[model samples]
Target chain A: MALFATCLTDTFYPDTARAVVRLLERLGCTVDFPLGQTCCGQMHFNTGYREQAKPLAQRYAGVFAGYHAVVVPSGSCAGMVREFHPGLVGASPATTMTYELTEFLVDVLGVTDVGAYFPHRVTYHPTCHSLRMLGVGDRPLTLLRAVRGLDLVELPFAETCCGFGGTFAVKNAETSTAMLADKMRCVLDTGAEVVTAGDNSCLMHIGGGLSRVRAGVRPVHLAEILASTEEEPWAAIR
Target chain B: MGSNPVTWLGTPPFPKAAHAALGDSQLRANLRKATGTIRAKRAEAVAELSDWERLRRAGEAIKDDVLSRLDTYLERLERAVTERGGVVHWARDAAEANDTVLRLTREAGADEVVKVKSMATQEIGLNEALAAGGVHAIETDLAELIVQLGHDRPSHILVPAIHRNRAEIRDIFRRQMPSAPPWLSDKPVALTEAARRHLRRKFLSAKVAISGANFAVADTGSIVVVESEGNGRMCLTLPRTLITVMGLEKIVPTWRDLEVFLQLLPRSSTAERMNPYTSVWTGVTPGDGPQRFHLVLLDNGRTNALADPVGRQALRCIRCSACLNVCPVYERTGGQAYGSVYPGPIGAILAPQLVGDMHDAQAASLPYASSLCGACYEVCPVRINIPEVLVHLRAQATAAKGSRGPEALGMAAAGWVFADPKRYEAAQRAGSLARFLARDGWITRLPFPGSRWTASRDVPAPPAESFRMWWRRTRG
Candidate 1:
């Protein structure tokens, strides 16, 4: 299996990427990181810079060509790879090989419980791309439900976008903030100690707001929580 | 005469308009309540029909069929309407459409006309044009009347005064409406009663009526007006002369096609099983209704829209405003920010294409207003790929700009770095230097464009080593 550690995870959330690798390897898979991997070009494609996105997409396809299965930690990047890659790089094996982390675990690995444990009251935000684009319905939730000692609370309006739409967060800051405020309010209402999502982009947006107000609700990647165990706690890594 | 252009003249770009709208706490609250309530009901309404997906597909197919053979269907409609004693006039643009209506009103020798809520007329600036031509167009729809009374532009497509709550509407009625009883209250029933009483006078006395059709069937030459109130029926039946200005895109091929739209529109727009009144008319009747009838088939940049294969799909819109109710941007900013009669996701695509000039700053700024959340597409009964069209329009707008200078150069430079692993690694190393600026592992603010991001939220600190670096060290 190949792991496409997205640009943000590679640069800022390396621990999350490491968690995915740890989780995957523990499940009896040899994880290969295509060193040549870079950005998914979602920012470029979404911002109407398709010409710039094209080459990056082609590079991505080239790097992960022979892998039978490619796993991605982030939902948006996985959606970009699965949904938009065909438009950028044309129909290819690479397009069909990509799977979001939860989808791979539930569908491919066929495992409800990966023998993980996370003792926290956490709410899961299903990012828009993961929910709508990938249609990764209940896979992440199913995985979370199985974690021993995990108290997974359902997020209110869980399917709505967190408004971290790539460049949209920066370009349309006020509206984005307004939406984030609503999402944060919902998270707070759940009274959960942590907020978790498949995509770090949304987590970053939600985390930023929570941290700013000192809300005491930490944002954790789903992979990190799923990678958690009685011996190696998820909290220790953060 | 007020010409057939949108009422919004000198409309600012989206960012400026949105900035003003965002500051309006009242407007935001109204939009949130209205949109949320409607959307919740719509979901329930849709879930009640198990074959909704089938209905949506059928609606989409019918519209696509109409668009593909629009010329054939339109000619068929003209013949049918003419046979039924209706005068079918063609307007190449808004100016022509306004001229047609003005001439018809003048022919009827009426200074004032009662109007049914029509987005087409609003799009063409008909009331403003009519007012300019020494004609008073009395808007009979409850929401339209509120907007007209307040001297404000119509905001939402279905509910023009959606930005105004009950209290504000009561104030508008108390201030602007002469017929408002002293005992009128801020409750919805009281507000609607005041409007009904006020419009009743205009309905009975007006010699001419002007409207926009919801669906104009090609086979029957029948024009349909689906409304919550019976205002549309009064405008159609009570007047001596009637004029309907309809977008060419509103045509569906056959009378049977009404089944799909009648089901889809009410459910999607108002979350109703069926609207309170749905009036359908073909041309003129001697003694039964209006003695004279005029149907203005309007182009007004629709031909320009139909010229592009991708953009033409937006014409499939049933004008349900389902997309608007589900859109986060519309909920936050309200409809006025869109600067056109059409607002929300549909407006974002339609306004730019209808304007057909990306250099026009107001139209161009619209395509970027959304977060590309895809909610609009999900709820769209006709399944118009609004997000797809938004990105497509963005590309067109970007191309029309010719050169973005620094932004273009920046993208190119970033593209270059991303193409090669070594260059990408080097760039990552350079970016990681920002760790020094982190306070407790989060960077709060930065320069220029990054400042835009940090203005509302903090960014995480770049890790000491990239993931690939960590991988190489451990694996080796």
Candidate 2:
């Protein structure tokens, strides 16, 4: 299987990509990182540049064509490749073979318990794309619950959007902030140490706000938590 | 009567208007409370049916059939209405519709007309037009009365005054309503009683009444208006001359088709099994209802929407406002910021298409108003894929701006970079230089376009080495 490290993860959140590699290897799967993959053109397609997105969609298909399976850690990126790619460049092997991390784990591998340990109070925020687009219901939570020591708490209004929305966070910054404020309040209300989600883009927005207010809460990726074990604990790099 | 001329004209683009609305804590609180309440109720109401999904499919299929052969259905409806002793008028746009209504009201020899709360009339700015022509159109619906009395634009579709709390409503009534008793309190029943007293005289005295149709049955030529308040029944029955301005898309093929919508609309909208009042009328009866009836069939940009294959689904909207209630953006910014009678996710897609002018900056901005959360799509009774239409309209808005715009240029540059792996890697390497700006591992400020992001949220500094660089170094 090949790893489709999305642009956002490849750049700012490289640890997440590395953790995916670690987790997959631990599960006895040989994960190949395709060097030619850059982006899935989600930012372009969603922000109204479909014409610009076409070439990138074609490029994504080209790079990941021969892989047995392509795993994307971000639900939105996987959703973009599967849902919009067909419309942009027609359906290709890349569109069909791609799976979000949780979907790949629970459905493809048939493994919910990855034999991981993360002893912390964690609340899972189901990102909009993951919840609605991919319909990845309870898969991530199912995985989180199986972790040796992780305490999974339910987030209030968990299905609601964290309002990152790629360019939407910047274009409609005020409304985006208002949405983020409610999200942060919900995260704070949960009294959990960390707020985790399947997508890094939403986490970035939520984390950015949590960091700004010095809320003392961490926004961690689901992959990073799953990658952690007793022998090799996942350290907070920052 | 007290509201200013209803016009979306001169309204700022969505971001600007939403910025102003976000500053109002009261509006935000009101919106959150009202929408939140309805959101839960709608869920419970919808859950009562086991075949809700199947019902949605049926509603979608029915509306799709209506939209596909709208001309035939409309002509059949016109014939049926005419046969039932109703005059039928076709309006190419808002001006024509407003003019026909004015002429019809004048011919009735009436200076005042009572109105059922109607989005079609609101869209055409009928009251303002009537007021200009020296006719008074009294809003009979409770929320409409509150909006009319307060001189306020409706911020919601089903609940126009959702932005106003009971206190604010009482204040508006006291300030603008002459019939409002001084002792009128902010209690819900008291407010309703005061409005009832105010509109009672108008219902009794007005010779003409105007309404917007929820559904127009092609086979029976019957118009349906579902409301919580019985005000719609009063407006439909009491007046001698009745004028109903209906959007061209509000047609159901047969009387049986209403069974699908009647089941879907009330549950999705007001969270009720059945609305309190559902007024359906054919044309006219001798002394039973209105002596004379006129049905103004309004095209008014609806055809522009119907032309687009993806956007035509917006026509399936029953004006339930379920999309508004579930929308995170609408819950925060309220409906006024949309600057259209249709607001929320539905408005974001519908307004831009209806306006059909992507060059209009305000209409162009509506497509970008949503976060593309897909919550609205999940809750829609007719299964309108609002997120799909929103993205499609965004493409139209971008294409209209041409290739020379800054955003377009940026997109082109990014596309060029992403199309080739080497260029993308080089760009990633260059992006790592931003690590110099990091404070405690986060970039708090950025320049130009990135500045928009950094204004409210902190961006993580690019890692010293990207994931590919690490992979090649360690594994290659």
Give the best candidate by lDDT: 2
Checking candidate 1 for backbone clashes, the offending pairs are: B1-B129, B1-B133, B2-B128, B2-B129, B4-B124, B5-B124
After the best TM-score superposition of candidate 2, give how far the Cα of residue A120 lies from its true spot, in angstroms. 1.0
TM-scores computed on chain B for all candidates: 0.97, 0.98
Classify candidate 1 by CAPRI docking class.
Answer: medium
What tens-digit string does per-residue lDDT give for candidate 2 at A1-238?
Answer: 9999999999888899999999999998999998888899999999999988888899899999998899999999999999999999999998999999999999999999999889999999999999999999999999999998898889999999988888899889989999999999999999999999999999999999988888989989999999999888778522
Indicate the docking level reached by candidate 2.
high
Candidate 2 lDDT score at position B320: 96
- Using DockQ as the measure, the top candidate is 2
lDDT of 2 by residue, B1-476 (tens): 11212238878999999988999989989998999999999999999999999999999999999999999999999999999999999998888988999999999999999999999999889998999899999999888888998888899999999999999999998888898888889999998888888889989999999999999999989999999889889989998999999999999999999999999999999999999999899988777999899999998789988999999999999999999999999999999999888889998988777777888888899999989999999999999999999999999999999999999999999988888878988999999999999988788899888888888888888988998999999886
- Using all chains and alpha carbons, the TM-scores for the candidates as numbered come to 0.98, 0.98
TM-score of 1: 0.98
